[model samples]
Structures are given as structure tokens and as C-alpha cells.
Target: MGLRTRPIGFGYFKTKFNDKVLQDEQDVGTCELLQDSKVRIIISQEPEKSNLLRLEEAPLIKRIELLFHMEHSSIPMSLEVDVSDTIGKLKERIQSIESIPVNRLVLSFLGNELNNRSTIHECGLHHQTHIEVSIRASPPAAASTASGSNAGSKKLKLLVLPRCGTKKIPVEVNASDNVGELRKQLPILQEKLRFSLPSNGYFFIHKQSVMDDKRSFRWHHVNQGDTIEIFNGWVTRGS
Candidate 1:
């Protein structure tokens, strides 16, 4: 038993070297607080039970064919529409298949103009595209060589003046009628002026000149109480 020597203590190796330098300074302060904070790790996406690989395909409404082009006509109006309609419903379907007068047309495309509340896919149009039709020019015969004519069962009170909301309305009309027959008296003057007339057709202006919906408010010399002015689309002039 002479070789049994026991000795391993300097306060137990200085308390295990101060608990291994306080656990290596708490593992270098948790690796410098995960290298200075913002440590986001996330990883959680588990949602695909596979109902045929999570099926969800149903979105295809895109119809466009357009071509219109008729300035002098050589035939170009194809119109398949539905890129969400609305250049005033493609001018009421080109005024019902080309009798033409959705306020004298005037569509246009790459050369601009297209704003009847815009849409045909917001004017990007697509498919055949070509557009441009223009028509509007038709009021001038030098006021039908004036003679101050006026007798188509005489009526003429007028005083309309409406670009929006009420400013004045009056309206009696007749004196040989024909300002496009006052659009059949616009639904009895929109129920005695409660408003809402222009369904894509309105134009009159008087003294500042523009009338001529085929003439006759005494050939637009208009009289009676005077002051016509309606206006709402369809009035274009520029070289």
C-alpha cells in the first residue's frame, strides 16, 4: 500500500478554473447575442394536402377582335368586343351594326381620342386593334340658304342650357322641328327636367352655333325666347 498517493487539489484546480471561465463567458455571450439581435429563423410551411395538388384554375374572360377603320370605307369593321366593353359600349355596337351615329362615332386608337368612359381593356384594345373611324362633320349648308322659314306647326319656346345639373330648361319646341326631332322630346324632357337625358346623344348650342341635328329650329336661327345650349359628346373639329 506504499504506492497509493492521493493529491489533486489547488482549491480543486481553482474551482475548475472558475467553472471554465464561466462557461467561456456564457459561450461568448451567446455568440454575441446571435450576432447583434435581428435573428429571424422562421421555416414553417406545411399546407398542401393535395386535392389534385391544390387545384385552383378558373379565370379566362378576354375576347378582343376590333378592326373598325372606315373613314371612307373599303370595309374594315370586324368588332368581336368584350375586353370589358365600354368605349361607350363600343359606340352602342357601332350604332347597331353601322347605321352609324352613336353621336357621329369618332373612335380612334393609336392616334388617341378614345375616351367614352374608356375600357375595351382600358384602350389597350388587343387582337386585331386598328380602330380609327371618325365621322362628326355634317352641319353646314350655309344655314340652308336662310329665308327665315318657320311653320311646321309652330311651337318653339326653348331656353334649355344644360351641360350638367339644372341651370335652365323651359323647352317647348316645334317650329318645323327636326333638331333630330328633339330626340322625341327626351322622355318628356326627362320627366319635366328631373334630369338624366344624354344616353350618348345630345347637341344644340345655338347662337354660339352647333345645332343642325338635321336643321329646323327655324334652321337654327332659333327665335321664340332663344338660348338653346345642351352638349354632351359628339362635337369634334381640328384639321
Candidate 2:
């Protein structure tokens, strides 16, 4: 990392040249010659200097694709967002597009909830990386309705991705069933995917958090086209 010439704005004058590299302190006299070369020389394996040099070459991720997985909205809008934008900034962008308050929404990628302090790259997202966007909970009355009768329930289609596998299972679940009930259907899923199910290592996830066993489908506001993801772990990552 230190071999790369880093363009430190207005910082060229601050670094002290290695006198041993030049052979004499008096011989290292031309600042103009150094600026034209644009190289930061580090002869010593000093941990602190190497760390600083690594920071100087930090990767730059400009854009990422976000897949909004909302209960009421199933439209797969492929959004390209700036990686420099922090998670908070990304929320604000979504808020402007969806008109939902940023505080009421959560974003997750690869089964991890993004924090306000993290940038997209810091959150392990890369170019064309897909993320899940959902409401933190059931929206206000304007957005939600009465729970109504359970008889109206329909099949809830979900995509379950195993941690150790690349294929995604199209899981069919009853809208009236709580997320925990999905476990009963695991045998069928295992048969379809031909993959061994985790004995005690998995749970249903939404909004980057584990679903409550007692929460009904009504409480979670699940609807058609909404996903019930199964991440590989006893608990959600970075939950």
C-alpha cells in the first residue's frame, strides 16, 4: 500500500524525508523535486506509519444497488446509490423517494442491519450489492388497516437464502401464520433444495431482526410478495 503514490492535498510539505535514503540531511534540499515525484517513502516497518499508508489507499465504492423489500410495495426498484453516503444519508434518500419517515425504516444487506455510523463500504456493501428495505414496524393507521379475519389469508411467497448455499428457495407460507411456523415446512424446503437444514442454527428474519415467535402475521404486516428470509446463524448477524 505504501508503494502507491497518494495525493495528499496540501500535505506534501508536512512529511520529513528519510535522511538515510538521501545519504545526507543537507543533500535532501529540494521540496520541488519531491512534489513532482508525489511519493511518500517509508523505509521502516513502523506499524503506525503502515497503518496510516493503508488508510491513504482506502477503497472507494461509488454506487450500490438497493432492492426495497417492503410489505405493501413489491416493485423491484433497482436503485443505484452513492457508497460515500452513510446509512443515515441513504435513509434520507429513500425517505425522499417513498415519503415514509426515515426513522420508521430500516435497511439491511446480507442479513445485517446497517448502522447510521457506517458507510456502504464499511457495511460490507459493494457495487451492484443488493439490500433489503422495509418499515421498522407496521405503519400508522393511514398505512395499516384493521387486522380483519384470518380466513382472508393467502400464500406468502418468500425467498430463503442459506448461508452455505448459493440458491434461494421460494418458500410458500400462509399469511396468517407467524414466522416461527415456517420451520414446520422446512422438510419440504430441504427436499426442494437438496440441502441439509440447520438443526438448531436458523430462524426467520425480517427488517434485519429475528421475528418474534408470538407475533402474528397481522402484527408483522406481512403481505404478498414480501420475503421471509432465513439467514444461517442461531441469531441474526450484527443484530
Candidate 3:
């Protein structure tokens, strides 16, 4: 084989070779074209499953004790749940044991609803610690009116407005809920509004009477639409 470069015309160079040489060149060019053809690459997604596993390597994976308060029942039960799991799953567990449906569930922790579509860790639950739950029960078929049941023993919808920049909270109250029971929700209120209520020397008043630890809402004749006043440990006429 011989290789040569020769000029043909117009200062634009061209090369003329022998037939055998030209054929060899064409074969080489064809080989290059074949080499340049598109090639396919196959990748697997199995590693992505591993990455998903690693993403959960956080402090949110821990075991915690949860307490369930069955509606209308004074007895409470305890269960173990992982902070990594959603509270929705815990509700499922409760439904399995208590025969209550998850959809009808009303769960609260530190007086806050657990139905926020968040994980236990995200909601600040901790490992090996106990939390409480209370089920929302259907009202008795015979109960009626704002004073539906005795001693507010039945549930009534009520609004609680703290005398601050705080917003009003509409909550279901039990006829059994007394002044002390209402005060227990102060921690939740402080957490939500980032403010504090007077720790001492304060009292809650409904109408003319000062609410005491011994009486329920029904004792004060507090109806559904009534608003109780938070006073500085005392009450006066029109106070």
C-alpha cells in the first residue's frame, strides 16, 4: 500500500490515490462510522432503594410509650410506637385493640391534636417516654341542649379566649370539666402562642361566681355560648 497527497486545482487541496489504496481508505472510513454509532447504556434503580434507607438515618427513630384514653371510659391503656412512624399508624394500632375506627379518632398529646400528618419525631415525641391519648366518643342519644347532661357531664362546644393577643380556641368540653380541668390546658396555650399566663394569684370566673377546683361547668351554668372571664384571683360585680 502507498499513501500520497497531491493538489488537484483552485488551491483547494485534494488527494488522488490508486484504486486499491482508495478502497482500503473507504473500508477504514466505514469502520470509523460503525464505531461512532450510538451505543446504549443500562442503569439500575436498585441503589435508589438504598439511598431511601439512608435518608431515614436520623434521630427520629426511637421507641416511645403512648397512652390511650378510651372514650367514656376512665381506664387508660399504654402502647409502644416508633417515633419514625406516623401517628396515623399508631391510631391504626389503637383501632385494632379498642375496636374504634381510626377515622373517628381524636388524639391529643400535651393537649394538641396528633392528626397533623406528621411523624412522632417531627411532633417532638421522645423515646421510652409516656404520652396520653383520649378518644372522641359519640354523644349519648338522649343528651340534649347546651346543658345537655348533668354537671356538664356531656360534651358541649365552647370557645376559650385568653385575655391577650391570643386567639380564641373553640374546644369541646365535658360537663365534668371543672375550673381545674380547664386550667390544665394552659401549657398547650403557652406553647402555641409563645406567651405565659399568670402562674399564681389568678382565678377564672363565670358570671358572678369565681370558678373553683371543685365545680364543673354545669355547676356555674356555663352554656355553649358563654364566655368565662379570667380574673386576677378575684371577682367583683359585673367583673
Candidate 4:
């Protein structure tokens, strides 16, 4: 007679760990400790067969290096900082070196301005990457003076007086007025004095023979008593 055989059932099982083990447990074939501190149980119908399996290894972590570029066009121009530096800290460093105001300065990476609180790494700055730093000139005394002079020069004042023949009619004119406008006003004098105004001629402003077409004269600079002498053609009568 052949020996009687029984089919073995194979299956996976899971369980939790505690201070006590179940006394009535009968179906469990094996147990494993998982990475999460939980217990795993395996079962098989054959009591002699081992059902335990090993856990897979975890992946390794990679380390990355960071780099950044710094640029500035003002005095004490060049600066190099870590990719971890904050924008606010950079502004403070710049302020210490140059007279430029921190508020007026702007920091940008790859042509984009960085937020005040933004870190260098947040702005896509990488190791060895170059960044452009633009520094704007603040409203200093020199800048204000220059702007004031420009505004003053724009105010219209008599640069040249309109003359009638050799009689010098003493007409008030705008220094801002072009030589062509002056020529138009002196049409009678131009005809009487045989002084046919050249289409392209020069005007004497502040003893300088500035060409009329160049637009060099500022009407605001000319005072009430300023004299503008118009030359006929290219030759001066004395020359």
C-alpha cells in the first residue's frame, strides 16, 4: 500500500508586535521584522518547510555640489559668495563697500531680479554659475545737481534778440528757439541788410559758433541780456 500524502498550502501573512504572543496561534508558519518596526508572518501548509524571506536593500543617497557667479559694475566691483547666501545679506555687504544705497540696488540671476528674502539657490544658482548684479546710482547730491541743471536749461530764456536791419530793433526771443525760427522773424532785416540767411548756418552762443542744425543752444541758460550773433553764410565780416 502507498503512503498517504497531504498538499501543502503556501501563502503570505502580516502581524503586529506586542508584549504578548497569542497562545491559540496555529496557522502561522514563520515571522519577519520589517523596516517599519512591524512584524510580518508567513504561513505554509507544510510544517517542515521554512517560509521566511529577506528584505530588499534601500537605495543610496547622492551628494550634489553648488556654484554661483557674482557681478557688479561699481567701485569694489567684484564679489563672490556661496550659493547659500541670502539677498538681504548681499545687500548689506555691498552697502559696506560702496556708497550706493541698499534700497536702490537690485540683485538678479540670469536676468531675473531676486526677491529680498530669496536665497541664492532658490534663484537657480548653481556651482560655478555666473550671476549678474546690477547697481543703480541713487539720488545723491551729484545726481540732484545734474538733474537741476538739466531742468534749468530747459526753461525758456532769451538767447538772442530779434534785430531789424542794422537798427537793432531789440526784440525778445527764446533761447530755446531754433535758428530757423529766428531767421523767420528777421525776414525784413535779412532782406534789407542783404543778409540772406543760409539754410545751414551757425549761431554764436556764449562765444561758441554752434551750428544751427546741431540744436546745441539751451534757451533757459540765456539770461535777459544775452546776445546771440547770427553769422551770414560761412564767413565772418572781420575774417
Candidate 5:
């Protein structure tokens, strides 16, 4: 019996012959790939780091604590409000808690009457700033009645921006009207409009706060030409 030598295939011979060259190429390729991957990781992280830096550099919101003094009272009342709050808004806060009529309340800082449209910061109010509170004297009964009636009868053009619609609905309403009364008119308003309004229960938002159904537009600080956002759901508090 003739014993044949074990045959070495051409593939095995080539691999063994070029082992060092293949290994060198693979090592260089791996180093280059690793360097590319590291560069990509660093580039991706730069944007995130910049975003964090920008956030850190952003200015903090300042809140001002104001001292209110009533002419009749010796004690000083304190209220904290954002620097961005309007004088009208501060008056509203005082009205809600102190039971003062917003229309009659007068706010004065440094002997200057603060306008309703002026912001707290614009009025040169700082933390612990003292403000004088006074009530306007009541006019004659008949004249007061006539003025009140005229004011109540005046129509306000409210720009209603529904959450689901693009077209703003401008409605003529009385400032004395409540939110519930306005809700009732939505269906009637839908009839006149080309676009459909939200059919389900909805609520109104004013000054970034939800408006109560029992409160009038004046109560919510909703003025003429103010935009009221209609949201299609009920907001549950304390949940």
C-alpha cells in the first residue's frame, strides 16, 4: 500500500505565507476605525454640552415682594408677585383676597399712579417696595347707576382662539357676562361660522389661568381685544 503525503490546499498555503501582512493591515484598519468612532462621539457631545451651557447662562426669573398700605389701616399687607405681573393683575389679586372692587381700587407707588397696563418692573417697583392703596370716592347714586349701566351695556370684542382651529373667532360680548353664558353661545356661534367648533365640554383660558364659569370677564381680567383660548376638556385641580 502506497502512503500519500497529506495534501496542503492553496488557500492554507496563501494564508500562512501572508499572515504577517494581513495582521498588519487589520491592525491599521482597526486603529483608523477606532479614531473615526472617537471623533464622531466627540462631535455629537459638543452640541449637548453647548445646550447645557446656554441653560446655565439663562437669567433667573425674579419675584418681587410688595408691601401694600391701606389708608384706613395701620398694618401693612404683603403680597408676592412676579416682576412681569401687570398693575391690573396685582389689583385683581388684592380684589380677590381683600374683597375690594377692582374698578375702585387705586395703586400708587412713589406718589405716582400706576397704570393698569404697566408692568411691576416698569413701575420701578423692587422687592419690599411700598405701595399705597386707596379707594375712589363714590359718585352720586343716579350718576353712578347710569355709568354702571352704560359700562355694562358696552360690547367687548373678544378674540377667541380655539385649540383645534386656525381661524380666530371674534365675538361681541359684555364684560359682565360669565364664562358659563359664553359657553352657551358656542353652539350659536358655530352655526354662523364656516368651520366647526368643539362640541364637547370646553373651558376658557385667560392670562394662562383657567377662567371660572361663574366669574365674569372683568373678574378674570379679560379685557377688550384680549385673546381667550378654548380648551376641549375640564381641568381637575388637586389631583
Candidate 6:
């Protein structure tokens, strides 16, 4: 190679170009190289590290322990409802948490059964307050028979039997109406008869027993102005 002046490869030769053009090309090439390097770096990172940053933040939670003063008559043992829960929801939750039947459970906030579909605040419930829950057992056969007879007199207005020499007043009610609704309308009747509505009382509509005790038979489709017998043995004056 030194003896003969043979033409070398193009790589050995140097060509001159405009300074502005050369600088622009170099800048463009540098920008492309930087972009490619950045992409490679990102691809080489651990996939788990990217996923760890995207996890959602955990929510703040607070727990409260509540002691439900349950009576021998009540089946629900404990009530640990959330502060924001309603009475209805609390009832359901209590039933679920205690493994108790909902039908056999009745919740009393303070001294009264939770009515009006109110919340814990509406029922005057406070943290660490004692909530009394009572259970009502099913009446015996003999008691139910006596209750039927007593209720029958109140509905039929006919005193088939006599007790204490007091005349039994008969109340004529619709077959579809609830016995409780009739009791509300006859406040004086409640006092005069000195009887309380049973929690599990049923209405005998056309010789058929309707188990719904919340509303009177008047709300259902039955014979209009039909007489409904109300068994008053479930609750007593002092109970």
C-alpha cells in the first residue's frame, strides 16, 4: 500500500460541505439517537415496577364495637352497624351477622320498635348506648284459643261468653283490613278492653289467616266491610 498509490476505500476520503448544512444534519441525527435511546431504556425496565405505581390507594376505615342488650325474648345477639347505616339496614345486618331469622327478630331503639323507617340518628341512637331488643315467643294453643274467642267477640259485637260481668264490645272490621290498624282507630277500645296487639297476630279473613301484621286488612283485596277477628293475647297491658 505504501509502494503503490492505489485508491483506498471511500471511508479514507474526506469531503467538505456547507457548515450550516453539516450542523443541521448533525443536530437531526442527535435528536433521533436520543429518542431511540430513551425508548430502549423504558423497554428494559421491570414490568412489575410500572404496575406497582398504578395501584389504587386504600380507603380509610373505622370500626366500632356495640353491645346490644338483648332480652330473653329477642334472638339477635349483637348489632355492629356502620355509623352511616339506617335502622332497616341495621336490622338486616344484625340478622345476617347473628345468623338469626329476620322474621323472628324485632329491633328496638331506646324503648320503642324502630318505626317510621328512620336512621340511627333519627331513632336517637348514640355511640355506646344500650339498645334493648326483646323477643316475642309464639303463644300456646290454649292461649291462642282464648285470644281467638276474645277477639271474636270484639269483631262480632256478640258476647258469646261472659267474664268479670263486663259486656264485651264487638268491632266490625273489613276482612282485608289489618287488626293493628283497627286498634289504632279504636284507642278507647284498647283501654276499655285492656288488650295489646300481638307481634305475630294474624287476621282471619274469610276463615283464612293472613300473617301480615304491619298493615290492616283494609289495604288488601278482600270482601268489603267483612268482619276480621283480632287476637289480642300477643301483647298485654303491662307487657
Ranking by lDDT: 5, 1, 2, 3, 4, 6
Misplaced by over 4 Å in model 3 are 1-152, 164-166, 234-239
lDDT of each: 0.67, 0.65, 0.62, 0.50, 0.74, 0.47
lDDT of 1 by residue, 74-147 (tens): 88979787898789888888888778778778888889889899888877789997888888865555344343
Off by over 4 Å in 2: 1-60, 138-239
Alpha carbon lDDT of residue 71, candidate 5? 82
* TM-score per model over all chains: 0.25, 0.33, 0.33, 0.28, 0.37, 0.28
Per-residue C-alpha lDDT of model 2 across residues 1-239, encoded as one tens digit per residue: 12232345433222333432221223334433455554345433333454466666978557667666665776755678777779998888788888989888888877888898798777877766667887876655633444445454656787766654456677777767776777777787788669666666777777666777667665787766666666656753465
lDDT (Cα, 0-100) at 220 in candidate 6: 46
Model 4 lDDT tens row, 158-192: 43433325433344454555555555566665565
Clash number by candidate, in order: 1, 0, 3, 6, 0, 11
Looking at model 3, residue 58 earns an lDDT score of 32
1 or 4: which has the higher lDDT? Answer: 1
Cα distance off (Å), candidate 3, residue 192: 2.6
lDDT of 5 by residue, 19-41 (tens): 22122234445434444343211
- Candidate that would win on lDDT: 5
Stretches of candidate 4 off by over 4 Å are 1-84, 139-239
Which 10-residue window of candidate 3 scores lowest in summed lDDT? 12-21
lDDT value, candidate 4, whole model: 0.50
Best-to-worst order by TM-score is: 5, 3, 2, 6, 4, 1
User: Candidate 4 has which clashing residue pairs, if any?
Assistant: 66-127, 67-126, 67-127, 67-128, 175-219, 176-219
Point out where model 5 deviates above 4 Å. Answer: 1-58, 141-239
